[model samples]
Every structure is written in C-alpha cells, then in structure tokens.
Target: MHTRKEFLRNALVAGCAIPFISGKDFLAGARIDDFSFTSPFIRVGLRRTYPAFSFFATDSLGQGRLHLSPILTEPPRSKAFTARTYRDSISYFNSPEDIVADWQVKCEEKKIDLISRKPGAEPFEISFSRPQNHATVLGIMREGQRVLLPCILHLPGLGTFIIESRVPDATIFYDVTARESTGETPFVKLRFDGAGAKGTVKYSMRSVTLFPRKKKIHRIPLFDGYRRNFINIFQLNPRLGMLANSSSGDARASTLFLYAEVARVTPPLTKTFTAMDLIRDSLETYISGKQGYGHPGWSGNHESLDSRPSLIIAASYYIKSTSNREWAQKNYPAIKKWGEEMMRKDSTGNGLIEYGYSGNSGSWDSKIGPANWWHTIGFGHEDAYSNILCYRACSMMSDEKIFPQDEHTRACKAFAEKTKQHFFTNFYNPETGVLAGWKSGDGKLHDYYFTFVNSMAIHCGLVDKVKGKEILTKLLEKMKEVGFVDFKSGLPGNLIPIHPSDSGSKEGFQIYQNGGVSGCFAYYFIYALILCELYKPARELLLGMMDSYAKNEFEGKCPNTGMTRVWKTWNGECRGHEGFLADSYHALLVVEGVDPKIPFLNELVHFLNALTVS
Candidate 1:
C-alpha cells in the first residue's frame, strides 16, 4: 500500500492549480468573501456540474444555432462563449402564474390547447400528430416570434422519444437540418420518414435565443462596484460548487455573510447578495424537488417526488427569521401536501419521512448483504429526525396561519406521540442507552451506533440533556479511533466510517465505506456538535475543515478536495481547484455562533415587496 507521505508528495507534484485573478482585476471586482466579478443575470457559460455532458449557447432566431444535430457537440472555452449576454429564457423570476399568463398571451392563436401542467409525481409527456404538428404554434410565424425556445435533448439522463411530421409543416423543421453549410449562412431542411408517409415536420429545435429586451442584468451586491469584475471570475469557477461540497469549510463563508447581515439588516450586503440569495435559492431548490438534494441524485434525471421534510423544516426556520409571512403561506401548502404524500409510511399509519431512494446504495440499488438490506428496507431510521422536522413545520404553519390552529396543534401532538412511540419503543437500544441507526425488517435494532442516528435523536429533541452529552462524547471517540483525521488535522477525505462496534476496533472491515469525512455531513455534524456544546472539539473539527481548503495564497477560497488536495479518490487524482456553496453555507452556520446572521432577510423583503406590487 502507498504510504500517506508518498501520496501527498505525488499529489503535490501532479497538483492542478487555478490561476489567481490579478490584483488590478482583483481590486476592480472583489466580493466580500472571494474573487468573482460577474452578474448573475448574464450567461457566463454552460457547464454540467456532473460530468458526461456538454453545454453550448444559441440565439433564438436560429442564428448561432448549433449542437442540434444527431452527434452531441462540445462547448468551446473561447472568450466568445464566456462573454456575458443578456439572455433571459430559462429564468423563472416571475411567479408560475405570471409565466403561465405570459405563455397564454403568446400562444393564444395556436391550434394547441396550450395548457400549463405542473410535474407532480407523474412525468410529463408531449406527443404531436403529423397534421397538427406541422401547424405553427402561434399566429406569429416561427421566424417572426420574439420568444426563444431552448430545445434541450439529453442523450443520457433523459430517455428516448419518437417524432412524426407531415408536408404542410415545412416551416417546422428539426434543428438538426440547420447544421449543413449552405455556402454562406448555414440552414438545415426538415424531412421525416414515418410508417406510411414522409414529409415536412419540425419536431425539435436546437437553439436558445435569450430575449435581451425582457431580460435585465442584475448582480448580488457581494462586493463594491470597483471589486466586481474580480468577483465575477469566481462565480464562473466550479470551485464555489465544490466549496458547497467542502465538508465543514462552508462555515467560514456563511459566517461572513451572517456577520454582514447582522451588521446591516436594511439594505443588506449591497455588495454580494449571494450569501442570502443562495440560502433562499437552496431552500427553493431543495423544497421544489426540481434540484437534487438527497444522495444518489434524481432517478433518470426526473425530479424525485420524495420530499425531504427536514429541508422544508429548515427552510421554515430560514423563512421565519426573515419574517416573510407571505412566502411562508405560499410555500406552506405545498410543503404540507408533499409531506402528506411522499413521506414513508410508519407503523401508526401516519406518514414517516425517509431519505434515500433507488441508487442510494446497494440496499436499494443492488442486492447487498442481508444486514445492509434490513438496515435500509423500512421506515424505522427515519423516525425522530423526520417527525421532529414535521413537528417544526406544523408549529410554523400554526404560527403563520397557514393551517388551522386546532389542526396544527392536533397534528403536532399526533406526530409527537408517534415519534415517542416509534423511537422509544422501536429504535432505543437498552444495552447502549442510545438509538440504533436502523430497526431491521424483523423490528429488532440493526444494533449499530452511528453519529447520525444520535444526531437525529438530538435534532428531534428525543434525548435529554445528559443523554445528549453522552451521545455526543461517544460520537467524538468513535471518530478518533477510526483514524478520521490526519496529523495536520485535515479530514481524511471521506465520510466517517460507520464502525461495526463501539470500540472502533478492526473486528471487521465491512462497515468502512467512506471513513474519511463528508462535506455535506459536516454541515449538520458541526451543528450537532455546537448544540451539544462540545466547544473545543467542534472548533477543532471546524478549523481543521477550513484549513484543508486553505491555500497559502487566498484567505477564503476552499480546495474542491478535502483531506488531501486531490479532487477525486481515484489514486488521489486532482481535477479542479475551487470552492463551493456548501463551504460558504456551512461557514455561515459556524460563524453565526460567534455572531448571529439573518441570511437573505432583504431578499425575502424584496420578494415580498415585488409580490405586493404585482
């Protein structure tokens, strides 16, 4: 086996470095935290956060139309693509109702129904027959229309589809045909072959035209005007996304914003709005189910209907702090509905919320061993954490008048009872006096002690003060015995190994998956530590996590990889160097202990104000 010293040496030699933006550029555009100088409204470039996909930009008039052909095209790193543009096609700043109204006005004269359908649990299906498919969507001819339709065809994530068209639809042609060079300006002809007939039909368009008139340029006031350009560069760097992936380093960035917010509550941080904006954005992204939140990601690129109640519960806290009552009302109903619908079923027949789905692990994704199978098979591990969150949401609903006061109280009590019954009776381990991670299919404990399980108990308020402290101490001991951190106090670059026994001894190696540490886990884990008042340990873990991302150069930018500088675990390979939102967000949580931060209070006000104006 390769020694740690040799591995670090090789990684340093092979280390990929991102060039720092110049000082002239830095002062020209510096944000409060890091270096990034672009506005959010403009298109920096297209990037697939996950690998195996490429993004290219196009103009709506079919002019700059590229990548619509059969073979997928790659995006160029040239300045032409990087230059910011006032593209406003995919943005959904306006409420869904307003967007539907706008779409209705535009599609009024079309032959189609032009109805708006929300993607609930069921997926959306669009099918057009040949004769009607040839007809133009609106009275305005295709070329005359001002709207830019981004026709995205995914070869991997999105499944396949069959298209049919006829002769009358000559104006309607597939964007693929436009790729052929017509001597000067290139254009593609649309022709299709069907079971019986072949004619003109345009099924898919391959470009996106950002209507500059409707779109406006805007940026979060994260920095002063002169420092903006430098700040914009960091926005384009994938590191921020990775920082979001940084185990506990996120606390530093988050703390800055929280401190800034506490400093000025009115105008807010006029320099960069990302601090608060991202929280709201994270809230919306997580709650909407449109963005991936739980591990294993979305199944087949489709949004999983399974709602993480904890996310909604956390959002409620963030929202309540901002005093955005209107938003609470607007989102509360959906939160409740999703909770009622998607949560896993408990023994009491009340909905039990569970995280993870198919592809989450072999327990669900593949045929794993019976122990792993039982640990994941049912709705037991989800008890306290899930119900506590639901209780919090219920309490908020009552406070916000989103639900009837009596109903809310009744729901809370019901959930509380279910929580006590399920957890105390089922999950509690008498031998250890701690909650087990999972209650097996046989209803017996999986008999494993996990920090998460204890954290969840604390999060749900199931453990008393004394028990909570004990649990926290045990978790820390468990962390140390497994060799979780290195000499420099850097994380081991993986998740805490779910040790097979309390002794943390090498009785068996089966339980060690990612014993290093996890970025997202650290976010909550640190919070657990803080609540338990394990001050020194929490500080050590937090500072260690921060230093792991620390470069000799910059103060804030975190390395995408933790434990070591290598980005990937594949022989400690390094790919990109940057930070992520999680790093900043977690930082906010940590720094708030030193100082309170009401994240996105102004954005909440702005959104509420806009709604009132509308």
Candidate 2:
C-alpha cells in the first residue's frame, strides 16, 4: 500500500504496476489465492495466465468495502473466460501494473486501450493496470451502425465511471457489464469482453472514493443492512443516466427520476466522466430529435410521457449539485426548446399535459404503448405519474440558475403554478382522500389507490401539506385494510387490485404491475410520510424494506422460482422477469436528503434524521 504522495509521485515506474492511494494499508484476514495488492483505497489479485480474479475497494475509515471480479469474455457471452495458456512468471508490477507483459489492458483518459498476444515460440504479452481509485471507466467505440458496442459501470452507493473513445478502422468486439453475483456475497462480475474481434479493444478500471459521513447515522437496521448487499440499478451513459429494465442492454429512461432526485448523483470518476456528461448527452439526443435515450421507448419512440421531464429533472440536479451556471447558460437554448416541446403536450390548454392515446380501459398495448413507466397498468390519456414529473420539470426549468429571465422561464413558472392549482381537482379522489392514477380520455377516473401516484404528488408539493398528510394517512389505512403487511418485500404498486380489463398482460393480480410489491415507489411514500410529520409510519416503512435489501432480496434471480426479486407478489412469489430493477432502491433515497428545493429535505436534515423515530 502506498500513500497519496507516492501515488502522485511514482504510480508507474518502468513496466511494473502499482497503486498509490489516500490511506494506509489494512489487510487482516483477506484470503489471497493469487498475487494481490491491498490498500485502504483498492485491492487487486492477478494470475499470470488469466485476468484479475479479484478487484475491491474500501473507504478511508475502512468501513465501506467494494468487491468485484474482473473477468474476460468473448462473443455470445456464453461464459466468462480468461487466458489459461500463457508463458510467464509471477512477476508483480514494481508497484502494481504490467503484471507479466505479452498481454495488457491500459486505462487511459479517453479510452481503455487493450492488447493481448499469444506467446511460446511467440511470447504472450498482456498489460493489466488499475486506473484511478473509486471509479470504473468503461467504453465502446463504434463509428456507425457497424459497431454494436456496449459498456456500463456502477457500484452500490458509489456511482458510474464514464469513457468515450474513438478508433478508426478498428473492429473492437468488446463490452463491459457488472453482473450481480448469484451467491449471497457481494462478489460481482465486471467483464470486459474481447472475444473474436479482428482488431484491438479497450479494458480498464480505477478507484475513486466518496467518504461517508463522519458521524454514524442514527441506528437504523435498514441502512446498515442495505449498505452490506448494495445492488446498483442505475445504468448511466452520455445519452441518459438510466435504470436497467433487466440484467443488461435494456434501459429505462423515465425510471431515472429517483436516481436524479434522490441520489442527486455526482461523478465518481471526474477525470473522464462526470454527472454533467449525462446532461450534455441529453441535449445532444434532444437536438438529434430522439424521443428517448432508451430504444425500448415502447410508446411511439418517445419512451413514456415522463421521459422529457425526467431528463429535465436529472439535468437540473446536475446543475444544482454542481452550481454550473456557465454550462446551463451555454445549453439553455436547447433546454428551452425541450421545455417548449413538453408544454406543447398540453394541446388542450387545460394546463395539464396530455398523451396521444385515448387511455380508455385496456388501451394499454404492452408491446408498443403506455403513457408512463408502469407499462402493464393501462395508464394513459391524463396520467398522474406523467403530470407529477411535468410539474417538477416546469418548476425546475423556471430556476434563474437554469433558464435566463425570459418569456420561456415565465411560461415555465406559470405552467408550474397552473399545474399545482389544477392537480387536486383533476386527480384527487374525494371519496378516498387520495389521488387517482389517471383520468381516461372518456372522462373517467381510474382510481386503484396507486401508491406511487399519490406519494409522488404529495412529495412534489402538488398538494398542500394538510392534503398530503391526509393522503398518506388514507394510503396507510388502505394498505393495512388490504392486509398488505409484506413490507419486507416492498410496498405494493397499488393497494387495490388492478382491474383485469385494465392490465396490459394476462398476468393476474399480485404479479408484475398487477398490485406487485416493489421499492420503485415505496421511497416516495415513506418520504411523504416524513414530510407530513408522520415519523413513526415512515420509520416502520423504512425498517421493513431494509429487511429485504439486507437479504439481497431486491435483485438477483431466485433459485427456486428463477424469477427476479425486484418485483414480487404480496405473498413473496417472484413475478418480475427482469433480473434486477435499479429503481427499486429509490425507496432508500430519503436518507440521501432527496432535494434542496423541497421543504422535506430540511426535515430529512441528513441521513441521521431520515429515520428518527417519533
């Protein structure tokens, strides 16, 4: 282990690889099967014949630990493999790089350059070096349609690393994925695949650290549990800092709302990737007229109605977190244009955003259409979920730090006020003291007591505090009334059963999107409760959910059912098909201190007060 000064001084000497970081070395009982380097910052174990068997990290206090397995993969992704046949000695990097030459992976600023050779009469050459610490930089170089490049990086509470590179005339067949391990431990697989490509590719990793708070958070079983088996659902890129719909490849543009609002993510590795990169890419995508960053923009390529607003919020958070006015000023024109496009969705001039579909019962077409993120719930026409986001987008767009004091900003302010004023009348259910999920095109209210819809409205300040409290009270009552005590699994999407005719899929009640339990919206409910000063209920909700996270119940497929755990039945059946849903962790965001503009943030104070029992 090297110190901060040594890291900056001689991180690399000759061809030997070594890691120098902020703190001292702390290795007590770590089992090492191969040549390994260990320190408070990062640890790596490498074998002469194959890729690194272990890659891990720890915070300065040595409290938080991150363990990863860096494996090599080729096409078909049939399995992860390493170079078993190699001519080499167990020569370590002077510090910790260039393990045995002949084969090598270089972590550069712009790209991860990779080169491997077969040696015998031919000497097999390889290069493996750890990049900066706390970050995982990954990339895919594709000039055009010829390149089907794929790369993604993320850690539990830490964020993603970014890499953007270009190589002309080189067919690099490689991608990177952080596959969650099947066993109970946090032994995740980070694969950089270069299978049968003719040319060169990229593979590299570095470490960065976000030191946790000095004072321990108030004792809450959930936070400690979640910290143990943390699973990352946020899949980020230049285009969109999205959430994974499943294990890999599929991206959900709208689901990132929580990542932006709750996590308020900053860049983990600032040298090559920053949170602002997502904002820039979003502008580029909007300029190119892409409806949404996710190709599964199931609804007319626009993703869902929430996409634009979600992106807007994400960008706003970046600006808020960074206080980067210059970036905002430079991009305001495109930003303003997006605002205008979003407003145009209010074709009726009723001050509420509208959708293209009729949203009549059963109007949801799973393969191609839905008005919002909950694809199978038959939400359309006038949607509460969409409006809640639209309200937030307009409210944030009017910020002086974002848009200049122009007519566009004035319009945003006015629209936000109008939305706030009309929201209750349009969506609140007088009988239930809660809001409905949506208003159908035929002028009908579809009220299933959707937990997300009401919670979102309340937390976004669409309703007054008094009304918010009333709604939360009613929601809690309904949840208990329905015998929905399975908080360990997560709160149900709706307390009442989704109508058969309204479900997009044939899946019955208590299944995916049909009253299924998930953290997707549970966080909002708990936060709203805390905001309304209902502390006990909020604490209870949080503790219950923490039980699930500690057990790693949210992600990874179940051995028996073989179904994913992010979404489950009230009775604990695995109904979700996606192996993992990152948005499920959004429920834990209240402790992250959500957003500054919202009054609830002050109530949260910090992680310490987030779960204080009253």
Candidate 3:
C-alpha cells in the first residue's frame, strides 16, 4: 500500500506507467500484488523483489504500468527468502533462486542497499534504491531513457549482459569474468567499485540469450537529417501496423486508414499477410451483406457508405506498397466486385455517389444518424470526402497493371475521371468559398466550409490548382477569423459551426464533427496546404501540431479520456469509436512529403520506356 503523498508523487512521475483504473476503487485500497505487470510485447511478468518500493516502467510496446523485478532470469532452483524490518535496517535472508550464493540484503531509506552473501566480508550493494529518489534505472528500457544497470552477468557461452536491478545515477566499475565450465550451469565472479565504495558479487547462470545489437541502416531518404525528432513518428507506423493487423477482419474506415498509413510509409513493417487476410475476409462479409452498412463502435458494421471504398483503397495501397502482385492477381475478381458495388451507390450515373435517407455514410461517427465520416453534421447523399476517396481508389485500381488491362480497368479509369469532374462541379460551394461537405437529393448544398472536405479535395487533386488555392486561402482566412490561428486548442473541423437544425442528428454546434477540431482530419488539411504551397501557414500549423505532441498538450485538453496515443480529435476527445486512432501520427510523415504512388509510378514509367525501346 502506498501512502497518499507517495501515491500522488508516483502518479506525477510515472506518466503512462500508472495502471488504468476504470472502476470506483480507483487506487484506493489497491495492493501492488493485485495487478499483473506483464509486458504485452515480451509476454514477461515483472515483480518487485522487496515489494515495498515502486518503480515505474513500460514494455517494448510502450504499454506502461510495469513493476521492476530484482530477479533477472527465472533461475532453476528456488529458495525461500524471509524479510524482516528493523528500526535502522530492513533485511532479507536466503536466496530467491539459484544464483551462485544466497543474498543477505540490508535496506535503508537514505543509503544504497548493502547486499552480501558471506558474513564479515566486503558487502556488494546496489545504489539508487533510496526511497526519496524516483529516477528509473532498473526496469526494462523504454524510449528516451538512459541505460543503467545494477549487475552484469557473463555466461559461459553467452556474452556479458547488463541486468537492471536498481535506479542509480552514479558510475559503476566492474572487474568481473565468467568461469570456464563444461557443466550445464556456469558461474561468474564479480567485483566492482562505485560511489567511493568497493564490493564483490557473484552469479550462476543457465542458458540465456541477450538482446540483439544491430545498427539500423536507413535505405530511404525520408528521414535523413531529422532522425531524432522523428523517432516517435517512425515508431508510430509499426504500432499502427499492429492495430491494423489485429482488426479481426472487420475492416472499418479507422482500421483501413491505419493500415493504409503504415503501408504508405514502409510496407515490410506492416503485417501485410494479416491485412490481406482481413481484407479477403472483409470481402466475404461485404458479399454476405453483413458489412456494407455501418455499425456502432469497433465491432464490424456496414452502415457507413465509405466502408466499401475504404477497403478497396486499403487493398490497393497494400498492393502498391508491398508490390504483392500475386495477392492482387488472386483477388482481382473480388476487387472488381467491390469496385462495382461502390459504383452501384452512384445510381444517378452522375459519377458522384448519393447517400440514401438510410443515413450518413462518411467516416465521422456521431451520436446522431448515418452521416459520413463527419457524423454529427448532415453530410449525407453526395459527400465530398467519400467521393474523393472513391475517385482515388478507382484511379489506383485502374492504374494497377497487376490485373489485366481489360474492360474492368477501362471502366474504372472512366469512372474515376467522371467522379473527378462531377465532384468538382457539384461539391464546390462558391457561396461558402469552399467545397460543400455534402449535397442532398434536393440538390441543396450543406455548405459549412468543412476543413477536411476541402483539404482532401486538394490532397487528392479532385480540385484544380486555381480552385484549390482559392478554397484553401479562404479556409485559412476563415480559420484565422474563428481564432484557430493560435491552435492552442486544436484545428477546427469546419470554419463555420454546424447548425443544429441542419444537422441530421440535431447535434449542437462546437462539439465533435460539428465544429470540434480533429487531429486526424487536420492532417489532410496540412497536406493540402503543403500541396497548395501555403508554406508559411502550413509550416506554422505543422510545427504547432508537433509541439502539441511533444508537450503532450493534445491529451492535456481532454484529461478525462486518458489518451496517450495520437487521438482522433485535437482536444483528445475520442470521437472515432476507438481511442488511439493511430492514423493521426501519419500527419508527421506528410510534412516529409510521403506519397505512396511516386515509387510505383516511377517503376511503371521505366518499364514502359524499356518496352518502347525494345
């Protein structure tokens, strides 16, 4: 049990290492033994040896709240250890497991623990175990933390390994060597001098392997100079890859976007086989009429209109990124079927898909009805965002020569062109000086000057250069007028607030998709600004966003959410059903100019030129 003062201090210092408590118990009457501090990545359980002190730690996967254990390996032999506390010293007798000798530990509040196996001899000890100091040195190494160790083990066959057992800032000098052995177990004699003291330690080791040491050679020039600042961003792709692969075949917009973003950056890091498996499974779901619609929460739903297009886009991206022609060729028929299903949405032959009164079909999941992605507002019928994605998907599939260049490919190309033209003509709202979010069957524009819709149009090249510049400039001006220039809170989803009356769900203004700033949506806006050559504003917003991430300000605004990852909303409100919408981190790479098509396109051009020369 931690004292109230100690608990508060640990809470402040631990950051994500605090265990997430959901019930009313909340840390009151909580025991250290009640929680299992296991690293999800390594699947290793961490236990505190003394159980009196707490050390905050995170696993390789960044899942924090792990306890530090003094015992490194699960030694083969176990011996009972007794702990007794005295006025000046706390001591432990016997060995917890088969080391070379049993440990007699003397713990004090102000000084390092004096550990000795032989009585009346130089006491081997560990520093930085003082209760008042909270510097972490014993637990598993997390990113951005200095490495410190209490012991170093040298096995007969294995190399020497540092064992973290205590938090110490002082330098340690070790003169230790492993004894040559032909037996199953090996022993090592250890002596060290540190902090103006000399000591001897010993260890017996079983078979163990050390963590591999390798120098990471970057083959891509994407992060040549800005490596250190972008380390977290680089790590984010693999984390997103895990989430994308763990979708259990649901394949919703959130999961698809996560997969697409990871695929865009580095294909091998992504779980390509798992994603392809899920995509194939999702195709069956779509065919079975179980997933074309949308559902609530993280579970598979098909009610949303963008779901089908999102799957196609994700698959196309996977193919383009991985150059997995076999997967594409094998699934070509299914892919065409999915594309045909998307085309069925555009019943009017106008190239733009119309949302029936069924609901909003975009990505924004609101408490209201079936709106598109911007769920709160009335973005139904023909949505600018979904249509742009549809056009992009169509174009990607048509350009993909992995499949035969037949009538299906020709139709896809033709449809993509039609979608582009129709979207530009219909979605743009000159009255609002930006693209309309959606246009209904009545042909009236739901023109709220949406930031995402307009920016995405620019990003996907749906809007021409002149129109894109004008619209983006107007958006910036409006955002400035609405006081989004400071961006202290977050980038607004829309320049103008969504009126309750105009919203299908009657959602109030200035909350969520109605007007709330979304970090996920803001990425496209920033990318669009870069495309439009609005460098100053783009650079300012990009730096501001990075600063927010660095200072953890995004989660600060919405403290109740307990969001440690890139959130869906800029203010950290979990809007996308899932809490960590990993795609938001994709914004960081966009400033580096990550275009998934460029490499593939370059290869295609080279191949074509070679064929022509031949």
Name the top TM-score candidate.
2
Kindly provide the TM-score of model 1 when superposed on the true structure, using C-alpha atoms.
0.45
Per-candidate TM-scores read: 0.45, 0.71, 0.57
Worst 10 residues of 3 by lDDT: 130-139
* Per-residue accuracy of model 2 over 298-358 as CA lDDT, tens digit each: 4454446787787778777867877778877777777777678788888777779987776
lDDT of all predictions: 0.32, 0.57, 0.46
TM-score, cand. 3 vs. native? 0.57
**Alpha-carbon runs more than 4 Å astray in model 3:** 1-251, 267-302, 358-368, 488-490, 504-507, 555-579, 594-614
Q: How do the residues 315-376 of candidate 3 rate in per-residue lDDT, one tens digit apiece?
A: 77667665778777777777788788788888889898766553332333435444455555
